[model samples]
Target: MASNPYEVEHGIKPSAPRQTRRPDMSSFHSALHELLPEPSSSSSNRNVGPTPDALRSLFTLVLDQMTALRNQAPAGVDTELLQGLIEELVVDREHPDMKGFLTQDDLDALDRVPKKQLKQGELCPICTEAFLDDPYPLVVVLPCSDERIDPATGLTIHVKHEKHRFDLECVGPWLLSKGSCPMCRQDVNAEKKRKEIGNQERKKANAVDDEDEQDIVDGLYG
Candidate 1:
């Protein structure tokens, strides 16, 4: 008797092909079927449609990347032009653009903010006034409501509130004195003052040297 392949090694024939039946498509499905054109040089002349969401997605991605980069960046860099603009706003009172903004109410408020005097006690370095206002001076209240008068100067350093803190007394006179901090001596006009003082010292030193030389000449002659 011939040995059966199925009974041989592994119990299966390696060359056997599995048979499958194809599903029959109904007439309705056959009528609905449509053929897509294969690419050819002639067919390639037709315009290709872009994916609908592609441009929008690309724009959104770019915007997101820009936002992330902006979040990662440090504070802004300074520019001389911007500095000049700020200086014009604060110091150049005569700048023509500034005239229209100063109305009577604004001027009154500016004037009413009160001159800060260096009192013996209770002076806020910020407002230069005694903190008579319960919480603090109106200006000191700005940047926070907790602004209080300095115990020594009677002015608002903390524990009060106001809109402006440019101590007119300190700033005004200091600006008059070549734009420097009156109390701390931070020179805004640094170059000008340095040059002035240097020249003055140089002149004094030269005078002293001249006096010493004349004294030596007189001693030699004697």
Candidate 2:
């Protein structure tokens, strides 16, 4: 109510229009961010794992190492040569009449293994059965140092021969596991290595002898 009638006659405008009391939206704006946070560099928002860039770097390093190893790795010709010789030995042993395969194994000893069937009393220790009464029964040969009668000298001679034979099935497992003769326990691998060393030594000696022989022939011609 207009208390003073005299003031109203002058029109004082009610004390600067009664300043309005606005609501405090500063706290409301702050609370909006707290409740619904913006998507940014917050730790909780990121996935926990190795980054893609890091994985790419690791893979690149592996590829480089593999490439380096491939460049430096040897061709393994010696291993391959040895394997080929072993296979050749098998082939030559099967077909002695066939020509053109180098072998250290004695073909005479191979053929010397009695083709006669095993006696009924001679039971295989592994299978505990006599040789099968079939047309073909497999017999395996292994390296051994055994004595044999010298035909010319009439004296006993110790020789490296494949005299021992066993059932194919029994010998196969035994060779793989032990690389040895089943009866004598003589290592075939050892024998093979020894033969290889001997062959190399012989080759070296022969090469030296050939050089000497050529020198003598040259001197004679000169």
Best by TM-score: 2
Write model 1 residue lDDT over 13-111, tens digit each, in one string. Answer: 455433211111232122212211222234253223223243233223323322332343336522332233234334333322211111112222332
- Residues 1-222, candidate 2: write the lDDT tens digits: 555666688876555443212112244334323322242333454223233343333223323322333333346312332233334334433433211111112222232234473555553333333444323555555556665665654544446544365555433432422345545656665555565675586578778775534233224421
Which candidate wins on lDDT?
Answer: 2
**lDDT, model 2:** 0.40
Clashing pairs in 2: none
Per-candidate TM-scores read 0.17, 0.34
> Candidate 2 at 17: error in angstroms?
99
Worst 10 residues of 1 by lDDT: 98-107
**Predictions in order: lDDT:** 0.32, 0.40
